[model samples]
Target: MALQIFETDPDARPAPKVKSEYTRPAFTFRSGMQRNRKPVKLDNWRIVAEELEPLKALAELLGGTAEEYSASAREPFHVLTETDSVEIVIDGAGAVEERMILWGPNGPIHECDGVEFLSPADAKGKPCGCPKELDQRKAWAQQGRGPKPNIPIRFRLAGLGYELGFGLLRISAWTFLPDLDPLKAALAAIDGEALCTLELEHISFINDKGEKIEYSKPKITVQGAYADAIAEER
Candidate 1:
């Protein structure tokens, strides 16, 4: 017989409850004596300078650490040039031998696309000609070997458009990111006016086979002098 909705019967018995296999299990906390507890990673941190505690007397050798949350990042981020390039030649002993700024095949150094050396009438320097192109630079290459600055480390200039008047821009690589003492020396060398940043960049160059090879190195620049507080500190 079909049961009607909401019908009550005196002979009816209560239905038995069935347990579900998909029921969620209860959580249990482990005791401190448990051997399989997960390890804690970087639970806490402290900020300290070399002048404090274990770092005492090591201030010259060690640096300081600042909390990212508590400290504010510096301002006036510097911008490097994408086209003009510079190069630092490191000796086998990891010391810098030479630093030069390079102008590509298409640069201000050349009046035309053809390669040649700079004429004496072009500038007020010595009688020796400045190479206007890669081919022209072969003789000036170290020991008359090959073109100078075969590989370049490109960077941008800072300040108002002052560098536009120059054909070639170059400086010593040491002019960048020095140790504390050296940094102070560099500031003094530049009359406390240079504001710069160093960056690691991956750049592509064409090999003899015309295949592109990529390499990474540090790039230096002073493009953010206006907004950088360090410039003002100088």
Candidate 2:
């Protein structure tokens, strides 16, 4: 025997489209965060680095075209600062460079190009002395000995920070640190050469001063050899 599933009329009228305030509201819960700031766009932008070696490793890992080899190229927007779990499509790489990170009595102060760092005279300006850790790491790397874990890696990265943007996009290239777990995993997991997404997570390093300190150093969490997944919550 056949069963009759519907009780209502077959030709019932459809519900009218109702526009909710949330659909395109003037004010939203996030209005406080945005503060009604108008968005901006750019028609053309470019980024050029004197060197390209620094970006080679990550670029190759992300995979790129021959054009990406150019020392300079047009792009959309430069990264102003690290974001929370930002989505990016890796385009090309920039020169490899080292950075001298200074942690003063206050906290993390500034990071200067490693090449530009000449001598102790530079430290004369900063509160902290020449980092003994850097010297030790350098010596260990030369002799091929000592605990060489968690050495800092620096390079420039060029890519689409997000998929959606206006024609007038913000184009820029910025330095990248592979100090986070997701980035480290993304690099390691590449099967020879491949394109993939990198989900970055923000991390903080506590400055364990014997006396109480007010501030702390922020870092990207580093996890597996090849991190394809977003970082797990701590």
Candidate 3:
């Protein structure tokens, strides 16, 4: 069943039992996507940022664990467009909190958590464009960080490159419990704010002609959160 995007409808997207590691099984460019079969597959990514671990780090990285919950949502989109749409859920320090859903081609669509170079704006202070930012990040992810991410997410047939984003859960890829552990993990002790921001990056795929197509330098906003906390320190 589709998860309702509005609060008036308090329907939780039933947790897909954690048979494997990625319980949520979001869009990953590597697996199931028959890249060899279908030329392009669209992935709707939404970004939402929330800082909830403030009081924790008021002294250190964070005080005790803060039970915060959030979600990354996109419009009932059959395909991503020149404009995007989405929403967010944030609970901060058991106090200051709220939600701000957005509409635009480049808004956030998923609950991302990290120092991700969110958009072209985030890459501003640096040299080059989004392509540069992505190259650097991809190389960084290659440093053997246990479970590799769903790298090279493709959302269109724009050729050469597609927008990119990732969800970082602090827990190990090995951390899996039978029941609702995965769901609990996704919406667990999230004191740190999730960054549902935007950006344009390159991704890999094949063309209709069954040839390698490299999505080069298109502005795709990847609004995801780092599944860890970055509080002010308590």
Candidate 4:
């Protein structure tokens, strides 16, 4: 006899789509000096020289190439702040040449391009610095280091900061020390310096084969603290 399968008489219903709220918002970063109201919103945006070089090493750890080359490609769009968490680069400028990040909040949300996200627990346990790891990863590169990571990636003046890449690479959810002035200002302004909570929204953009051009919409959500800071700084 053929194997028989029985189904409990039940109706199938379409599931409603539940969208996520954690998205990287878009807003301009202005120089604190010119504004004159509060400190500059960009005032909080400063580069953390030492922390960034290693951010690359960490990216390679997630996924890049074991051997280093003069390849100046990472992710299409990345937003990196000084490891101190002060300055931030949103789309592209330094090592990045071609711009690919999408603008506007609620624009689009695409999976990262060969990107991986780790839990907070996993991130905090990593070793400090990337000298050895960077040397090892960058050793085989023939193209040469793109441009030693720069401080203050790029402040958009009236818009958000952007740091675009050539490949798919990013670091999310890592905490910074108190010495980071930008974070200090944003935090104190947002939470009244009571040791409150801060959320660093991380986003990834992936274009696996450049095939999904139509669906490759990017999404942003820079409201609340991010928006408030921008307003006050201006």
Best by TM-score: 1
- lDDT against the true structure, per candidate, is 0.30, 0.30, 0.28, 0.27
TM-score versus the correct structure, for each prediction: 0.25, 0.23, 0.19, 0.19
N/CA/C clash count, model 4: 30
Off by over 4 Å in 2: 1-83, 91-96, 101-130, 134-234
Query: Tell me, what's the RMSD of every candidate?
Result: 31.2, 25.3, 21.9, 20.0
Model 2 misses residue 129 by how many Å? 10
User: Candidate 4: where are CA atoms >4 Å away?
Assistant: 1-18, 22-132, 140-234
lDDT of 3 by residue, 19-92 (tens): 64222212211111223457453342222213322222211211223222233323111112222222222222
Name the lDDT value of residue 62 in candidate 4.
30
Worst 10 residues of 4 by lDDT: 165-174
Residue-level lDDT tens digits of model 1 in 12-83: 656678885222211100011111455222111111221122222112222332222213322111111222
Give per-residue CA lDDT, model 2, range 47-69, as digits (tens). 22223332233234334311232
Residue-wise C-alpha lDDT for candidate 4, range 11-52, written one tens digit per residue? 443457888532232221112222234533331222111123
Position 78, candidate 2: lDDT? 23
TM-score result, candidate 1 = 0.25
- In model 2, the Cα lDDT at residue 112 comes to 38
The Cα RMSD of model 1 versus the native structure comes to: 31.2
- Model 3 / residue 90 / CA error / Å: 7.2
Taking all chains together, the TM-score of candidate 2 against the true structure is: 0.23
After superposing candidate 3, which stretches have Cα over 4 Å from the reference? 1-79, 83-190, 198-200, 204-212, 215-234
